[model samples]
Target: MALRMADTPTPVRHHRRSRRSRRAVLATLASVVTALVAALLAWPGAEPADAAPSTFAHPGVTVSRGQLDFTREKVNAGAQPWKGAHDQMMGSKYASLSRTPKPRAVVECGSYSDPNYGCTDEREDAIAAYTTALAWYITRDDRYAKKSIELMDAWSGTIKDHTNSNAPLQTGWAGSSWPRAAEIIKHTYTGTWGNSGRFATMLRNVYLPEIINGSNSNGNWELSMMEAAIGISVFIEDKGSYDKAMAKFRTRTAAYVYLASDGELPKTVPSQNLDTRAKIVKYWQGQGTFTTGLTQETCRDFTHTGYGLSAISHVAETSRIQGEDLYKTDVGERLRQGLGFQARYELGEAPPGSLCGGSVHRGLGPVTEVGYNALHSRLGHAMSNTQKLTEKNRPAGSNNLFVAWETLTHADNPS
Candidate 1:
């Protein structure tokens, strides 16, 4: 007979059953794995969806698109405060189209001792480029965009390196502006920036590497370098560089700006080997009075102190744009205290003789807007001294080193 009652063959039947069992097991395993993966992805500690984005988040870096848009809207409607600030910037020589570009192969700047040729020129050009870019963004004028592009292109096309004692500082100054201009233009303007790639390459090769490692000369040097590194990291969407720069920035800021809660001495970078109190005190310019808002460079001069403060503000602002709210952290507190303390002196209050030997070299510069806006406007903190100074210096301009046109960009900025 062809078929039997017990079915075909015992071995064949067993084999078919075994195959079906295997298939069922495999399916069950796959389902379990999928559920586990989904759970993991939903976990709080899961990896960020985009640790780094290509274009950076809108209003990314230091100034966000929202902030820019607000400025534009206010200026267009002829609002009181922003309109006046914008008018001041446009009237300034920084926004002038007649500005010239001076590019060099190697920029060498000594420590206020011997500044090489093209050092000042390159820094000013970079600032002018940023100023023009801001003008373009606010007014939607093609000429401003074109001029900004021209200035950036000139530097990218010609400059290859930075050298000398002031190289890092010079690089920090020029480096600070380059990425700001590039970020605004590359993201906002529709015009052709054919050399954008070259510009990116310039930042990556020439600027990022120089400042990414940071400096040990002074608080300002390292702070400014960190500012450059942070800005460039945002432009290039370098998550690694961004994290590294931010870590360094936090450490340096803690050390640079002091608070009474920090215990007996200011926080010190372990890499700097400032473990001993003697070394720390000396590094702090022989100032034993560790009060709130006293900076490491306070004994040196308010000008240098302003540099450190400016970098702190810039980094904090950029961090906020990138989605981290550092303004409420110890960083922000230190900044607020520092600004207020310095503002008191700048507002004509006589610094105590015990402080900085009563010879506080004062010239706080245009460094208050960013911190003032963050601490006062955003957080609703009572920053009486800072508010006074910031309002007094309406339309704050550039320090010609790194800071520029902060009043126009950050004055009462809700964003």
Candidate 2:
């Protein structure tokens, strides 16, 4: 479903319990369990050789530190007062906007309303929760942990009664918020739920189950897969959860790939028209440009095709990590072929006006210059050891691909 943009008034009362008692319980439990689990998990015999030393510390710890320092500095810098009459009228909404709600299962949308919009998702709340929890994990700051636990409690509570199949019952409508929670839980508590068990139970019992059981249309499946993929990564430390998650992931991934290729996206876009085709073309061009412009003939003008690439990327990465031979399957081959399309298009080798009813656009300048920098950066670094590529030549966009070619030329090497 499309996100409805509106400036909704904040609700004064939420269903979550007060933070005091919740924090005391979660804090005590987290302290004891985290220490024991950390010792067990990081014991010399438990870890693989390549595990990052800090991975043993906790998930999202560094990100939390960065966010907290940034937020604290922002707050200390000063708060600006409203300058307009309308701003005064909207007083409390502006102030309470930053407060994190307690975790709950079924979020109430109608309670918050204003002239501009009806309701909004609490993405910021989830972000705050994860960041605060992570900070607590690193610094053992009771305030941060308490705040995080409060947010988690609110989220869990909201989602408990959510049964909506047409829309996400929680904020960040897609799988966004839950992943952050999972990261916080994994890192802060060393993979054990401790006081966070209620939050984990909410995710496992409510949020994730709904997403998994939902339809495959509108990239919902892919979004679900992303959540599952990240969730699997975070929880892989827990063998039982990891195994069950992997099985679910395999099923979901297969379904997502199938629906994406068999024409599910065109149905999902708001209007099935030429504009939709253009958007699809731009999206594919963006993907191709990111991959150095390798062409895939089969994917020309496939609507919302980037969703498929994203799904494939998640699956491939997960499979690689699990030491599965992804190349053995037809699905794997198709994914590789799609990646080729992305590469060829990025390199300006894809035939001009060949797709989208001869209206598809080309040139990496538009797609890669602004959109594909991070993608190129990650791929370029990952491929460096296997391929004779240098960081300077592998900048963040299509220009980097050009630099790479120039480097290869000067070195008398063909890329």
Candidate 3:
């Protein structure tokens, strides 16, 4: 009596059976995919999915065109710090119109630059190029743009490779500035750079190959390397390299800056294999106790610690210029705490002997401008110590490495 559709070999029954089978197969595939995705995520050092920007902003390496325009307006209006900073930069040897560029086919650097061959020259030339580009933007002077182009062309034609122990770090330092100059000159400067493609080729072949993969050395080493890689990728518009460098920046920032939430010890880089607490403490420069703002290099010294912070700020600033506000994220939080901690000590606060054996080194360098500007000016964070330290060191000039003229570019800059 219940002669259903299954009793008869009808097309409807066959269709129903087929539909049920398809649903079962689909469910099985979904389960398998979930398991595979979970496994891949658990795997160490697994590369993250690509998240490159679909359309990159021009002149978007550590500075935006709008920011440049704003700075120009401020400088033209005879503003306090902007005008002073511009004058300081213009007076520096980097902005000299008759400056020369010294490029080598090979650059060699050792620990602390023992055998420094072409190391200082490369770093200075790169900073000079960036300075001229900034000058061109602020003054609308064709001479500055041409000068930047000339410096870039000289290096591109000459430099073939970087060699030795500090090659990666050296490349990272120089690489950071070159892209800033290139991005500004190429996108904003009206003057022609006939050899711009050659410069791009040089960066792609020589510099990118050296630092794109990042360093496994000190946290500062990797931080600087990623800084260079991020800027270079934007200048070259290399999407893959951009993604890879951003990933490295994120990971290194977490491991470099400690937060109270990161358990008793600081977070470790998986590649560094800092599995045990003992290994982590040793890797953290013998600093056993972890604080919210303690850096991996705090016990090592504050100078290198400053380097790490500067790199983080530069990369975060670049990301912000490219339509992402990293200053509003955990990156911003770490930067604030790191700056505060270093600033408190640099302001001559007596430590409790728990930090850096109670004798932490000073001289935090010209690394506070960008971070202070972003966190305090834009996001409105109350940083009395950072403000005091930043104002005390106004008109920050070239560190002779990567950082240069930050006071001019980032002081109270909202954009």
Candidate 4:
């Protein structure tokens, strides 16, 4: 019968038609499958039209639940470096039980040259709050948790505005720690924080608006502010704010960290109006020699450069926790190069005469922990200079401006 059908002209034509129909069906299926995969890759965890997860997903933000648990386990097992760093944090004044939070109606901090009265108190209290939170997390002590809540509530309830010229920087400094403390206390602590809502409101109303717009001042100013904005956005579960902060962070990071591929000059923020080469050179502190790892604030000093680098790492880490891996992107490369370049100099490499007039101002601070953990341990990147410097500076502590207890949180953290 098959031979008879094959020999039939009509049947042969029918068979050919069937084959074409099958091919068309298969091709359509393949197109659909390809489209779905493309969509998934383009926007992970969100529909093509929908925004990403909004609201503070517990164990989200800069530190994830897995990471916190890992830290706790290491600390409990009395792991070498973790134990030492834990002792360092718990022994500091920031963790003292007798610490009192001094809340002000208005905090007015001038630049370094002209400081204000409550500037130190505000910054220290914020640090102390974070310290107590770490203590609570490690020890399961109710007292420490309560103390952390008290500090947050004190500032949230009393502080209405940050005034004067140093307002943004002050807010950035305190704002950065508040969310880290809040995330730990709100998610991990079993104790009831009645004013936690007020704290959220404070962040959303007072801090978020101030920093979300991004700054055009020195690169450090905007970087630190965006760092605060990004952390607060995660805590509040505001995906829109998070996106804005991340975009600005990318721009500022590129401008701050120079790469050889960027031609003879470092990149500048387009909005900053550094259109002319001369203008860009001026903004870069007149340092014309552009190379990998050179920062916009390098000529200013390493201290400011450290601020920029720390903020970039913090934002990038937070983004990674949110399921968006910035480390695999250009942002990550910039951060890695920036950290390596700074670490090399910090490790006692004298500057060449072609760069910064043959001398570099060194004060990169304790800012290498998160970046080191991400690049070295997780990704298996060879960062010898950063690794050596990080090991040499184990139990990295706070810089007193914003960065604090990074070694305790991020040192060799696989999670």
Best by TM-score: 3
Candidate 1 has which clashing residue pairs, if any? 59-64, 59-65, 109-166
Decide which is better by lDDT, 2 or 4: 4
Per-prediction CA RMSD (Å): 10.6, 21.0, 6.2, 10.1
Best by lDDT: 3
lDDT of 2 by residue, 168-200 (tens): 323213344345445555554533345556666
Model 2: residues with Cα > 4 Å off, grouped in runs? 1-98, 102-105, 108-122, 133-146, 163-165, 168-176, 186-194, 218-226, 229-308, 311-351, 359-415
Q: Lowest-scoring 10 consecutive residues by lDDT in candidate 3?
A: 1-10
lDDT of 3 by residue, 339-369 (tens): 9999999889987788878888888899999
lDDT of each: 0.85, 0.38, 0.89, 0.84
lDDT score at residue 359, model 1, on the 0-100 scale: 77
- Native-referenced Cα lDDT, model 1: 0.85
Writing each residue's lDDT as its tens digit, candidate 1 over 1-415 gives 1211233344565897867666776777777777877774443223223434344574365788988988889889998678888898898887988877889887877878286678888888988888899999998899999999999999999888888888887888888888888899999998889998999889999998888988888899989998999888888788888877877788788889988888888888767888789999899999988999999999988999999999999988998888777898888999999999999998989888889888788899999999999999999999999899899988787888778888778888898
